[model samples]
Target: MTDRQITTTLTSPEDTCALAARLGPLLRAGDVILLTGGIGAGKTHFARCLIRSVLLEDEDIPSPTFTLVQVYDTRQGELWHSDLYRLSGPDDCVELGLTDAFETAICLVEWPDKLQDLTPETALWLGFDAGPQDDARNLTLTWHTPRWDTVLKGLVA
Candidate 1:
């Protein structure tokens, strides 16, 4: 399938989290979300919100900056939260077994631009941009396959 994209301006962490919550209902067991954004752009916050929406357990979802990856067992499925900001290239992705995670679970990866070479054609690209004011964010959703076209529509709806 060809790529299809959508963009949305989000304000506040709550707004970003709301988007994540909305996305939660649309997710299946094996979906990949590649998130790109600068520091403080709310990527980790969004990830946390997404996890909270699906995780059956009441636990904190920490940013995996140092650990590299954090795994959470959710009601929907296993959620793999990966932070690739420190990664140098696509090789790091392969070494970290991310390709396998992509195939096996619902993977939410931050700083995915680092894995440019390995970004799959089936993965969904969700970018966060700085907004006009502090505490505001802009999320741009780009789909690499038609599989997400309906999902994106639901997000907007």
Candidate 2:
């Protein structure tokens, strides 16, 4: 099937987090969400909110910038949040066990360009960009597989 997409403008950081939390409950293991955006585009905030929404307790969710990857145990299963910006190539992902995690865990990946050919065909793609307002962010969600169709059902997302 063809790709399906939805675009929305987040008026503020809270609005961005709200959207992330809205999708959080629909996730399951084996789901991959590729987050792409420039610096300060609200990627980390959205990921932090989504991860917290699935967690049973409150905890700090830091950007996996220098750390590369952060794994959390959630109600759905293991959640892998990875920032591949520092990686020189896709081979680094294999060494980090990210290729396996993408198949078994609920993954939210930032700087997914580093994944190269290893990028999953079933992954949901979220692109973030700056909006007219300083605090506003334009978010676009895109998917090629039918998996996200069910996840986005009823939400008109």
Candidate 3:
């Protein structure tokens, strides 16, 4: 597979949400998106928007910080939103069933650094960063598979 990446700026929460919404429809069951960044970096916000975008009904999308993982039934299929921050080791991913979900559901993992060796090779990695403006955010998207190149085309331009 080919490796590729892109960087985009979100001037506000709306911008970030819009970006997430745009990507929602493109996800397939096996897709895994690893979100990495520091606190308040917009990882959950992005995941929330994405979940809402494809869901069949209104749902309260909460941060999985304490709950660890949240499962949703989107119109497309099962979606797993996970927060690995509280995890003590990569093996915790197995206990969460994330290892299996990674291949069967659309998975969004926040604080994926905790994943370490368990990180999926084909997963898309999206990193959030503080932008120049306090309300703005810089997002970097990277993937080692060719499918993303087609999926992300024109999404940023």
Question: Which has the greatest lDDT?
Answer: 3
Alpha-carbon local distance difference test for all models: 0.85, 0.91, 0.93
Off by over 4 Å in 3: none
For model 2, where is the 10-residue window of minimal lDDT? 148-157
Candidate numbers sorted by lDDT from highest down: 3, 2, 1
> Candidate 2 lDDT, tens digit per residue, 76-144?
999999999999999999999999998899999999999999999999999999998999988888999
**Using Cα atoms with residue i matched to residue i, what is each candidate's TM-score against the true structure?**
0.92, 0.96, 0.97
User: Candidate 1, residues 40-131: lDDT per residue as tens digits?
Assistant: 88888989998899988789778999999999888777889999999888899899888888888899999988788788777888888898
Is 2 or 3 the stronger prediction by TM-score? Answer: 3
Candidate 3, pairs of clashing residues: none
Q: Order of candidates by TM-score, top first?
A: 3, 2, 1
